[model samples]
Target: MAEPTDTAKTEQVLTEGNEAGVPRRDEERLKKWFIGSIDQGTTSTRFLIFDGTGTPIASHQLEFKQIYLHSGWIDHDPVEIVQTVETCIEEATKEFTKQGHSTSDIKAIGLSTQRETTVLWDIETGDLLHNAIAWPDTRTHAIVHELKNRKGADKLQDICGLPLSTYPSSVKLIWMLRNVDKVKKAYDEGRLAFGTIDTWLLFNLNGKERKLHVTDVTNASRTMFVNLHKLEYDSTVLDFFQLDPQKLKLPKIVPCSDPNAFGSMASGPLKGVKITGCLGDQSAALVGQLGFSPGMAKNTYGTGCFLLYNVGEKPVISHHGLLATVGYHFGGQRKPVYALEGSIAVAGSAVQFLRNNFKFIEASPDINDLAATVKDNGGCVFVTAFSGLFAPYWIDDAKGTIFGITQFTERGHIARATMEATCFQTKAILDAMEKDSGHKLAQLAVDGGMSNSDLCMQTQADLIGIPVDRPVMRETTSLGAAIAAGFAVDIWKEFDELKEINKEDRTIFKPQMTTGQSNGMYKRWERAVEMSKGWVDDSDDIPPSS
Candidate 1:
């Protein structure tokens, strides 16, 4: 008889077990199992359904309203966020089932959300007390200033691995307690419930019958309430913030990937599906990129840009201004891995600015085509500090400024400058990460909305002088969540198995600019960044409404 062909072998592996003698039951489970990921981001919420091999089979995305109450104040409706998530899950799962698959095939779900966005509600009635405070909102700037000057405030970094800033949930929560009457009333009555987006979604998804209030370590780490060393809420920090344990209803911090911690969906097309994973959006992107070991790093360019450099099991406090965060904890016997993260407050939002503020283009994708029209930035440099600079600089005083513009400048020049601004900031963050981690990045695994721009990726490669690897599936944020959920259900038994999935046909952008040229451009960018600072010297510039 002729030897079996490759197709026959593949068919045999699909129908029967391979030479490893895997049981038929296991094979059938593997064949039918599907994982779902809810990627709740700053500007949008998306749900993606993936098979056992990590390939997204069905997905749905909804762009929700971003409420900007004031210049630097941002908020989102808590109810809207929850409703949008439910809608996405229902729609995506419907498509999955419509494709001849059963809802039972979706064995597990994972959640990835924008970290540090705080929501407060009533524990008994589940009524949202106020709109969700977005991470980028600077309403807590005064509170942060007060905390910074208070006694023992300086020691917060040592305890929580984070400095007092407007970015964390602790500060946002404090702001709400002091400003919002409803929140204060709830706190006084011992009914105030506090959580990030993940916690809020989990609570609502589990339904009114049995509300589950919990958060993953990755999301909890950004809140400034959890101690990096202890992996739980620290009493000392709580004392410093003057938050009484008797009054506050904080969620329990659980492992990033757990089958039981995040409860099943109470209703929807994916009703009763187990939630096995929860991660901050950036951390989820890192896991989705399979950056499981030390020295591996990934950049996610969503509403903002975040670079996470994995530093292995132990947390390394950044002496270089980066935030130390829990990367992910795969529940079982494994320890949680830590990472050094650098956040850029603006990335794709700069592109959105062009569309919404400047009307430079009708849509975001038009930016790439328009930007490519110009050979370079045309002697223009844009400092995209719309909500101030984050990471190494931390110049909250800076405002968005475009310098080097002349009468000859065109829209293309501004577009190019906008793209370059993000690239320059990313390079700055990478430099800080290198200094902090003592490891040089050979390549960067990138994903998110802005990463879709080949022009932007090429610019990033040229500026950083490293290969930029982008996978065919640019939705790694959702993919990461799916991977975590799949891990819990044994759809993916080991990390080594993920290496074979989603590994084919990657796009690599190589550096094309000379070192001297790149350096010259970056120096000009630095000067522009410096010039943009102190633009808002008057305290009145940021009104009390924020």
Candidate 2:
């Protein structure tokens, strides 16, 4: 949507405030009260505007270029990620202002970013020392290998509830320190500032002023620096990487809401807005889904896959390879909740690979139609190891593989198998989640791009042998961030008020596939995953077949 003419905006903003259908405080203030959400994801950037009840009124989205200078090296132009993000925030709010709302309505801004993407910038100049090394970047593979080589590899799982894998930010930070010329210079000059996309945006968003750098607990855990128990950077972990603590400004790790944890939005269509909430994308999606109670869980199928199970009040370190992360930490809730997280590195992006690379399908949803052509996969199984397996199997070097192919295995069969890959991986992660939490996931609340496909939802429910719930609104990540900001700005009095927000407009898929078929299909998936093991590529090549 384009900007409204000045007169039109004046009339619309006023008209919306005058609606008699509801009783909103300070109709004049409500006219100016909007929430801004900046959602930075693996492949794209999006900005959304929300009214008080957790619905997106307007949004703008853009996809950025991913750089793969080497087979394992994935990067993003830091400048592009920064600039595009700001532009989207402006554009989305412009749309809202045009349609009976005003920029001033945005009382607070919340942030949700792709976890584990590392950035290093100069404090003095505020310039990126290197491209934003993305979460999928594999340049840290060797660093993880070296860390594990030291005698204490097994001890990390107990401390962090995670194994040595390239997915974590610790190895990524170390790789930059040892390899990047600019990072070394900054370190020596006492000008180094390290952060994920969150810190990068925070610095830039605050006009590079006061260096108001911080990360929510959810993002911090992805970096190996944070001691899960203390919520501070681990001295031993920092020493292991040989990073100078004094030289770099460690962002104050804070909860997701209210005054202490934040700074205000300096400029945009929503200029002068006080900024207050932050979460890594997946965690925000959980909050958006309103999975506040224990036993409630959500799985988002976006560029990658993430499952978060709400474990109330205290952290539950996983015995399995699953990660222990902060579920939500709002000012309204005195006690913080925890989650057992399982990440699979490929999901909707797997279909994008087929559509863009091999020319298997022109439109993504066509894969859904084509896959449904057959009742089941024709003994074909696609193992999506694009960035290697995550959770349960943290194989850094493993690449993609496909097995059980025969002459009967047509494109339709392969397409069906690809979709099944996501379902199968979710099942594996869910099994581990249940094992570690000792709490069975009853019905999974799901959102994101792939959840739009009915077939995929049924497949996910059937494979896991549980019902899958899909909400009317697909963009839960943004909604989650909005919830945090709302709490910070006092748009709602308490966390319990959020429960009244309707989710009854949902579709629930129940398991119909017999247990034998589900187990038998899953066993084939296991074998395919086994074949994908130890398949690493050191040279530049196409990302492994999804």
Candidate 3:
């Protein structure tokens, strides 16, 4: 027999791996396989391309408009979000191809989206019925209050693992159903399609040509509709909300890492690529940080701060005001892992307030430099409750407060206080996680926009009295989706193999302040937070439907 040619050898290697159902880890094979991730965040939409080793090769990010129609309300155009995703994919893939990589090498795509942002659209035409209700929007406060007063409302936490709050998609969906005539009409006619950001993106990306509407377990967990134990929409909860599933077209809930649920991209640069994975942003951050094992925890500091502590298989319902949520579920025989989460609604957004609202800094990063100029907060403590405090505190009536401000205070002092506010909230959440999970975090894996600030991270370490690990990538949200996608396609055969990737150089911020000093500062922060409560008088405010 004649020796096989080079082309024949390559074909045999690729075909044999598929036929044998084994992962190909050869360097040559790895060089030809790439994974893509769409990180649809609150402030921006990003498309990232990564090689098998979890290194980002190319990325494109676009900041979409944040619509504030009224005070304490936030919305986003669903159509614009879809367009941004397509634009990012096209631009990023072009850069990837420009860097001597084949667009065909992009094997699969994963999605990490901002969770709980409600989107309603026409089932047939796919036209958005209303602006996507942002997770931070407080328009649903009255509805949340009314729901809380109902009989069986307190039991909601037992079933959904979430308290009645405007932060959830269910409340937002309810608001749309009551306020938007188009949404109500569609629901009455059985033509309304409801989903979180991930489902909306998946539906639009898969196009109207193929009927695809599904949300991952992590995203579904945030809607206050799914039962934590059953991992499906609860009938009792839906009935309590007066929502009949038969009337509204809700997305099907799927696994976080699935080979086929998400469907393929019908258009854009990644037209033929299979979408194999999907996660909410926080869960994606956890996956990106490789927090797969029990007792591992990660904190993502984006527009908001989310700390997820992995609690193994069985869910531990939080008695400490933390949330019990599905961390990630890689389908097919793998059991789902649970997490105790503490969510802080304002983190990087506080910095944005400083830049845009206060004009204390010209840019977001400049707050760090300015903050470094101050030796201390000069007795100032900012509660940062611009959108109400979340997590252990759960004080929705609180407004942003700046305490101990005197003639001696300057922008630097306030900046320092601003940074400290997030650290204090993180420390509060960490304390709650430990209480709920019974696992004291030895160290925290950190990622996202605010984690880039060395001062902020060091402060976090000091406050928590533990090490803070920040990966060099800082884009772990995207990396996490890429990791999930890669896993589904057999590019990454096992979780053990992931340990070898993205482990080169990481920045570790160790505790520097004494325990007593840290405790004292936190105590002062608590006092400031207490003082900020009850500032909002909701009685005079009109209802969302009005």
Candidate 4:
């Protein structure tokens, strides 16, 4: 036989399929695979569709209303958040199908949500008890102080891997149970369901019928109820918050990637598509960036900024102020990965502040052009402690304060300083992470809205004294979710299968300034931070609107 050529082999297979009464289109369809990711964020909701190669083929994003009921208070209508997710899925699916692909090609869906944004609902009625308390909301400021004074407060981080702070869902839930009449009533009656955004969305997305009240380890770690070691709810920690493990309807903790832990959609554009994976947004970013090895780190700049450094399979309790959190846990005998995290309360929101409040620029990206006009910050420093400084500083009384503003300072100066604020904080976090982990990072993987700006990334590289790597597709958060889902469904079987995903056209910003220059800028930032403290008194909370 003249050995069949490669083209002849393909033709023979197709001919055999046709002769076997199988449609050629169905055979061709087997070669195509897709995954969907729901990236529910603080300021917006997004649904992205990705091919097997981790390329985003279609996506849609929608910014929802940010309810500022009072100073330092932020709320989101739980109904609106879910609606936005459905709309994004519908729109993104339309786009996906428009590109000559079948919806059946979507093997599974994954969820990545803003962590610690607490949502409570009536377990029986499935009605929200109150507006969702966003993670950054400081309405629980008083509660945090009380929590810090409570017995076992000092041992909280050891148990749950989080400090006694306003950011965790536990504090917010405690505040509601004490203050909100309906919330307290529901709690007393055992009708209350407590969940971070993941649990809430999963509850709704899987349809109220299934009532899929579950959370991945990454999200559960932020609730301060999970024992970081066991990866399960800790009754001792629950008691520390005055929560009854029996009464409170806490979500079951599951792995980040699982075939059946998260149920299939009941109805929607992706009806019956299994939700095979879920992770907190920052964790998803790390997974998407392929930061699987210890000492590898990734930073996500959304409404806020979070830097997660993988510390291997075991959790490391930070002696520094950074948080200890689960990096990610893929199911099926895979051990949970741990991370040391440093959170900044304001990042892209500062640009929104300049655009809306200061009118310094018409849009976010415009600030980059404006900042470029100024060679440097012109001695201006903006301590964007809008609610309060988070992570290493944990300053509760600091308000947004601009220091070193002078007659020579312009909006461009302020813009440059605003950009530096995030970069400076990142440098602080990176330094602290190195100290805690005992390994110096040579580079940082950066993503999210703010990382799109070349100027900002270059500044980050200059300030941090390391290369900043930004992927060509900046939607690593969404991509991470898809990767998790893909893994669960066998679209990808192992970590090595992802080596080629999101690997092309990455821009690496290298250091452009002297070490002395970087140190000087950081020193100025530290001074500004110190000077901005104590701007808000303990009793400075604004009363909620009637």
Candidate 5:
């Protein structure tokens, strides 16, 4: 099934348009409209071009380095991250033109980024103050402990809809201002600018002239500064961190879908193209799946796994240990949609561990084939708590452990167990969502790298006792941003018009295992999880007595 050539497409368009006797301008308009999306993830950067139907026609992706200066400290070079984005845009644009499509066809662009990765820069010099602290970094653990015990700490979650944790960008910012001298000096001089990855990319993409410093509500909600109800920074939350807004130049908060909030790109292959849509990576995936009404849920299995369930127009403070955050804000008269999110810190990365660290396979996709060799886990269970578990458990002291291993345990069994680890966590999160929202989802929509495996999706369906829906085009994160951009510019005026986008060739996996058998396997996984904790004692990192 080769793609049609440029000559073939041109002929087909002209023949159809002339047969109908339609005006030339209308036909040209149909041929010249497209949307671009910049999907910046935790481990890679991508640029994708989409037509009005939401299919990614041309795209390029680049993986950047993850810097680990110390244990539990993961940082990314802010300069290198921005450069990779520029390169992706240029390369993707070249691909589009090679197919006889002009850059002018791309009417608008949208951006989605890894949320809560903190970056600081000089407002005047435009120089990065330090490396971007990634979301999973635990350097702020000590600070998080201190903040949790302070006065009014219990009220923080009610105000911000997030518990005090090291994942928030505000926590990372506080750690830098106290320890990093360069950041402290800039703050003292009133020249410091702070932002998440979205804000950083927007600043550079707009170039020095515009210097547009802003972030959308989806990204802002993760920073622990924005009030869930007000959609603006909360003074009480800022006071808890002892942050002075006068000293630090924070990015202005804007709606997720806006026509003119984020200015046009100042330079690039797509120079002067307006950026009209933005979302945090997970939120963008939900939009791409068209989870518009209440009760729809989507799970993204990327570097980490996230399950977000729509909680309708108002925020619901989770009593089941989930984070409450904004789903998307279309701006204008539309009310903001809120969601309950469950985050598992390790998903596809565990597969990478077996490939890169353990040498079990040469490529990522090989795990599916390898695991398929075995009928089941062979009484084995792997608790992939590499950096400890997340979501409902939130056990920081746990470590990766394998249980029920005998001489009979083959590599195939281990591989199957590894895949089951993620499925088990997803099931746990779904249960929590059901408790908080009081509605059991009929089916789960899934996307991202790991969802490509039929074995994994089937395992998910069996354990959760619900159908798992996967689309043929798995790049929904990019498509979600493209949808936002299209709506902002009137390329799409209503949600009903998007019903056909990415709707064909979808695969749905139904439960294959019986209820009793699935429940038995899940119970064993829970037992393993409980045993895996308390392995990393508080004093394990301390030097032994001389």
Candidate 6:
């Protein structure tokens, strides 16, 4: 099998052409040696080199600086993200040289990034107007709340398959235009440039001279501005916020993984290598974990816990709080498959709060061991609302609240309960997915940093009453990029042929808790969630951007 490339699915044909869809150079000059997977996330950026089988031959990673301008504000320097990505590629290629291989084998590259973070800048100057406003930033909560009351707010959920919340890009972009100095003035002057992370990186990576401005279908769907059916930026949504479609620059929506959508790296050691695949972090993790068929599911434990269940073809408008999302437009599927996703705002970061905020634990892993020390929760259950609840119950007003603290409750119990908080939310999401899709989860394919925990996996299994499968390689997010990159360059002919590439020792946790125990514990979790709503007052009276 061959490797995956950085091309979008739209660019996967054996034939090649330039941005104008015309052949500017020899199509055969496009190297077919390596595919680079650039995994850009909330905290860090990485560059991975892969072969035909979706295996990582070499990789490098670097964490970037995060700026919190104000409380509830989260931002990233687009320049920093691009530079770190370059450094990662350089470092990885240096390591590759140490392994007695030249960087020449690199064929294509794929990118999976933190979704909904927006970057505004001058199309000519190549300078960012402001830091990237992350999806979780609460600075826009004011606008979110204001819109929640308006008549169109109720209709937004049906059209976009997403609730009118701070998590999406539409509101965040609106907030930037209204609150920021340059963003507002520039938009008024029609000089503003806007893009999600992938678009920003693609423009930076390809060359500032000829802006490579196109967003993959998967990322565009999350922005709320894009019409879910037409897969283009909607004028109605633009008008709802009283914004100018002309000033707010949006990239063309294209397929998820193709070799030529955004050409290869132009400045890195792998400069000539073409990028062929791109996806948001969670979507890439799904594809990387090989959730190819319908009924396939995975829960990525990141800053937030995102649970996705693949539902094949044509979007199923989710009745529940879950978002109807594109599984992938591999540019090969009969039609793009969709997913019912339950996104939780808090997951692994809850443990981080215990370490940095509460000073309860010395390190992150200590929480896990401390959790395992306690046989059970000791009647303590934690509702991780550090960022409020998501999916099934879109309680934007909730804050992190720990409940049922008793005389016997200790750090160990809290630790276990903290981990269980993730599991419980995950179970709720899976339950919601099952309800909406009418498909009970047979098993869960797990990846990401937290899935390494045997205790957490077992807890997830017990709560969800399904088998939890932890892949051998936790880097499935990057590997998925590799897979798409390889597929585009004809290194791998089909998905099944590449299945054995990342095979490793597996861990499977089967449901052990009895139905009665599961029910009673879940009921307690429900009560805890109800109590959590008062943290901010979920009543519609809360101020927008509150």
lDDT of 3: 0.88
Please write out the lDDT profile of model 2 over residues 224-317, one tens digit for every residue: 7887777678877777667778886667788887654667767766666767888889989999998888878999999989999988877788
Which of the two, 4 or 6, has more TM-score? 4
Write candidate 4's Cα lDDT for 1-546 as tens digits.
Answer: 799753344334334457673313223332466899999999999999987677788999999999998789999988999999999999999999999989987889999999999999998889999999998898887788778888899998998898888889998999899889999999989999999999999999988977789999999999998899999999899888878866789998889999899998888878999999999999999999999899899999889999999999999999888999999999898899999999999999999999999888887889889999989988899999997999888988789999988899998999999989999999999889889988889999999989989999999999999999999988999989998987787666568657777788999999999999999999999999999888766566477699
TM per candidate: 0.94, 0.91, 0.94, 0.93, 0.93, 0.90
lDDT (Cα, 0-100) at 208 in candidate 6: 89
* Model 3 C-alpha lDDT per residue in residues 467-516, reported as the tens digit of each score: 99988888899988988887677667567767756666999999999999
Give the alpha carbon lDDT tens digit for every residue of 263-361 in model 6: 767886888778888888888888888888888988898778888788877777888678987777777654676777889887777887788887888
lDDT of 5 by residue, 1-546 (tens): 899654344335434547674322233443466899999998899999998767788999999998888767889998888899999999999999999999987878999999999999998888899999999887787788789899999998899998887778988999999999999999999999999999999999999557788999999999999899899999998998998999989999998889899998888789999999999999999999998889999999999899999889999998887899999988878889999999888888889889988899999899999999999999999999876787878776678899999999998898999989999999999999999998999999999999989999999999999999999999999989998887787676567666777889999999999999999999999999999988655457876599
Superposition error at 157 for model 4 (Å): 0.6
Q: Give candidate 6's root-mean-square deviation (CA, Å).
A: 6.3
lDDT: the better of candidates 3 and 6: 3
Q: Rank the models by TM-score, top first.
A: 3, 1, 4, 5, 2, 6
Considering lDDT, which of the candidate structures 2 and 6 is the better prediction for this target?
2
Clash totals for all candidate models: 0, 5, 0, 0, 0, 38
Best by lDDT: 4
* Candidate 5 CA-lDDT value: 0.89
C-alpha displacement of 347 in model 1, angstroms? Answer: 0.6
- Candidate 5 regions off by >4 Å? 1-32, 535-538, 542-546
User: Scored by CA lDDT, what does every candidate get?
Assistant: 0.88, 0.81, 0.88, 0.89, 0.89, 0.79
The lDDT of model 2 is 0.81
Residue 416 local lDDT, model 6 = 88
Query: lDDT, candidate 3, residue 152?
Result: 93
Q: Which ranges in model 3 have alpha carbons more than 4 Å from their true place?
A: 1-29, 540-546
